[model samples]
Target: MRKARWLIAVLILCAGVALSQKASGDDAADRAAFEAVCGSCHPVSMASDLRSESEWKETIEVMVKAGAKGTDEQFEAVRRYLRQNLTNVNVNTATAAEIAPVLAVSEATARDIVKRRTEKGNFRTIDELKQIPGVDAVKLEARKDRIVF
Candidate 1:
């Protein structure tokens, strides 16, 4: 009985350590990507402020337009890092302006989202976002976890 209990505790401890290490690895990768791409042009501090995912996307777009050289994967990594760290908008309750920056959609699309919500009701599922005109299904899928009911 004593040996069995000890073994169980050891397994639990190992599992916890593995999970912790995985989380740290993810953070490290995001940090590395952020530094390598975004940090190359300006202080990483420039991105420290919390912004909506849409806002981060816009920032990345502007940087690309201004000739910030990076592959699509690198730009995507930076965008994901920013979105995970910064986005806090609630799609169910936010105004068009608030939704625009968080979802990386144009103001017109944001307005359409709001209009649909108003005409129908509170969205019960992320999939319901498809009802909005001009919403990209792939983009919405990528943001599913971050979105609030």
Candidate 2:
């Protein structure tokens, strides 16, 4: 009986470990994507702020059009991670992901553009952002006037 109980406990412990490990793997995958794709423009100094889930979805849309170059699934994953990390309770110090939603572009697009802008300082006008990575004068011509604070 003693041996059987010990075995049962061991099994439970192993299962718990496995579950945590799986969760950790998912987190790492999100981090990896951000670093690999989002790192080109933004510095990976430390974890950035994250915001709302709904906003994240929108941000993803913007990122896609702006040249994020991710599959729909991957984009969604990034969005989920951002939402998970940056809930509404913490918007003020929200990381880039959180702010992504509030941006004019979708979360993902906002992620790309903002990170680039963060590294580059600030964008005061559309004319200045025209030179931004995915932004061009032609593209700017149509939306330049539309861009606002």
Candidate 3:
């Protein structure tokens, strides 16, 4: 009985280790997909800042239109990886580079945002984003959850 119990305990421990490793391996695959697909155009850091899942989807769509290539599975993996790693960023204090990717806006728009913030102080609410020229209020409203003041 003692020997049987010891064997059972060892088997359980081994199974746990195996399961943990499999989870890590899945994460590694997602990271690989992210690097292979998105890193082709820009550094992985470009997508490291947080955005809502919807925002990520929109960004991915734009990238596809812009000639970024990847399988649907790979794109899904990259999106999942981005969603898991990136979270909400404070737009009020974020740089143009940081805001561009996270907000899924043009670099010019990001520069405008930074410039506006510099001139007018921090944004008090998402509604104020409309004050910036070329910012679509409807789109900004859709992504409000990812934008923080």
Candidate 4:
């Protein structure tokens, strides 16, 4: 009975790990498509610019017209990723995933933002956010309109 219980516990742990990996894997695939399609013409770094879903859709259409190569599914993936990530983020509540693309920062920087928010409380301004190590002041300034406390 003890062995059976231990085996069940291990299996549950493994299943939980697998589920989390699958979620990250889907995001990874979306990110890959975004990079490949956008990076083909210019730096994928451009994706960091905060935009509404409509604006991103327009930009993607223009890129496609300019011969950005991607299948419909790939383009859709890019659109979905941008629409989801490159939007207004509440510093008090956003996850690293949401903050990273909107601020044009790395995942590490975004995680730092989250850590700071947890430790120091909700950020009230761009200056407060900039105090976090790894966050770029310039990028935060540029995307200030997309940030909320």
Better of 1 and 2 by lDDT: 1
Give me the displacement of residue 117 in model 1, in angstroms.
9.0
- Give residue 26's lDDT in candidate 1 (0 to 100): 78
* Best candidate (score: TM-score): 4
lDDT (Cα, tens digit) per residue for candidate 3, span 29-138: 99999999999988978876667556777888898999999998998898767755664557788777667755667889989999988998998988787878778788
Q: How does each model score on TM-score?
A: 0.57, 0.49, 0.58, 0.59
Look at candidate 2 and tell me the lDDT of residue 73. Answer: 63
- Model 2, 1-149: lDDT tens digits are 99999999999999999999998999888777766655555574433544345555576576567776766666556655555454342222345554443332356655666666657766666566555454446744543333443
- Write candidate 1's Cα lDDT for 25-116 as tens digits: 97778778888887777898877766665667788889778877767777777776776566766777888877775676889998998888
lDDT of 1: 0.78
Off by over 4 Å in 4: 89-149
Which of candidates 1 and 4 is the stronger one according to TM-score?
4
Please give the lDDT score at residue 42 for candidate 1: 85
lDDT of 4 at 137: 91
- Residue 46, candidate 3: how far off, in angstroms? 1.2
Q: Judged by lDDT relative to the true structure, which candidate is superior, 3 or 4?
A: 4
In candidate 1, which residue ranges exceed 4 Å CA deviation? 91-149
Overall lDDT per candidate, in order of appearance: 0.78, 0.57, 0.80, 0.83
C-alpha RMSD in Å of predicted model 4 compared with the true structure: 9.0
RMSD of 2: 16.6
Query: Using alpha carbons, what is the TM-score of model 3?
Result: 0.58
